[model samples]
Target: MALLDELAAREAAMRWLDERTQLGTQTVTQPDVANFPFNGQTVALLLRQQGICKPRQLDAALSIRTTWTPPGGKPPYEDVEGPDGLVRYAYRGTDPDFPDNRALRRAFEHQLPLVWFVAVAQGVYLAQYPVYVVGDEPENLRVALALGNQQRWLGVPGPDEVDRRRTVERLTKLRLHQPVFRAQVLGAYERSCAMCRLKHVELLDAAHIIPDGKERGTPIVPNGLSLCSIHHRAFDANVLGVRPDYKIAVRRDILEEIDGPMLKHGLQAMDGVSLTLPKQRAQHPDRERVKERYEEFLAVG
Candidate 1:
């Protein structure tokens, strides 16, 4: 009878998941799960025992909690993935109500991906992953309650095996490269877009002077340029080119074409302008790398 009852309960939980998942749209954490995924290890343990340990948190996005508090709750620390691909989420052990420690452990043990939400002035930002939990404990150097792991979001089914493999590979590469690259490049550029000086970090992207897969292409800052999203796209698509001398050049065909406000001002108008550079000479884009990429651009043009 107890086994039957447990089976019935499991069926109920599965039913809840089915009812909550939107059939047409992407899967997100249902309100109940997202609102308070885990309050502490006890809550997390209870959820896991009840067969509710895993619910997709939208895209499994990861986020760093900021100093800004939400209306009622304090924020969690930003999780950091190290150069070796190990992720560490630190927490102060003082708060018993802080459920992240247990939650992280459960996710690791079960091999489930978890979503991290960070509170900010505007709203919450999130990071998610199928991280392989390496266990949680205290560290001496930067000692705190830490949950460490490597991100490996590969288990979920995709359109097919090839697509799944490709997606996972790309995600792994970005996990290893993007954050460090962005941080170094943005710091050098003082967090502004190099092309148009757009100041928002969210609007900025670190673009490679030499494309990432090329012979000399690397993730170092000297080979990076912080550009706004639009300009990054333009730079990548060959609509905009940066010369060895750091001048901006629009493709001749794009400059010659008549277009609307976006093209007229955003792209063509910026032609022949010198790039806004980092104040620190050491952080400046390497001219040799720029020359190599420019040669490619000229060849395409």
Candidate 2:
């Protein structure tokens, strides 16, 4: 019995993901996971029957997936992203010694990277790669994963390491978490723009009501809006905003400006329109955050 080279597998996974991203694919499908090329041959990155994927030739777990819970529903197991930015994944069925769990533990011990397929919708997933199983917490029946180069900063650090850790945190949010955030927010709105109800997933994005740099501006469903790329850019630039009551508001100057069809129809036409929110009230954008953002829009206008 032989295992595939861990480094080669990780490189292949990254290459596969890069190709997908370049093609504007925001979500990974079952077929995408099933027929990936590895080691000059086709290998399944995930299996249909298991969330923890370790192919016969793989010594370490290839990937672990988590599903999106329906609105107001509980997940089979709780996987949490902590304040320190590490994501904790529960072991299989409360058994830290389970084969899948042991493989994950081995991944940590061997410093091998694994893919974490985070569900953006019921069947749609966002693939995050090069995440190392950094901690094997047998006591808690879970393992901790660090994205990209984040594991480098897990231990006690010097002042420079502290700054580097902050950089990694920011990059993790940008390169890894941002896509997951997009998937979750867009999925929450059923892949439609909240303002215009545009349904093109390729053009959609999760806009922050309060920018992520702010203390209270965490990237969660309550703080995000499903917007098309144009609307997203407009919102970010204060050209558009949503009032606390969920009314679309284009900046006064932009509304009155005679620019182009995109401005008149895309932005101005949306002014005074009621925003289309997620059906589940709990998933709606935070009113206070919207108000604060709208105020900034007002100040700019």
Question: Looking at candidate 2, what is the lDDT of residue 154?
Answer: 60
TM-scores across all candidates? 0.51, 0.80
* Tens digits of lDDT, candidate 2, 6-40: 77876787788778755324777766767577767
Q: Which 10 successive residues of model 2 have the least lDDT summed?
A: 150-159
The most accurate candidate by lDDT is 2
RMSD over all Cα atoms, model 2: 3.5
Off by over 4 Å in 2: 1-6, 17-25, 35-42, 71-73, 82-84, 150-164, 197-202, 260-262, 279-282
lDDT of 1 by residue, 1-301 (tens): 2334323333343333344432111123223333332222212111211112433321111222223343345544444544333444564354422444444444444443333322112232222222344444444111111121322433432445666545544555565346546665776787899989889877888899999989888877789999999999999998899988899999999988997999998999889888899876766898899999899889889
Q: Which has the greatest TM-score? A: 2
Residue-pair clash count for candidate 1:
9
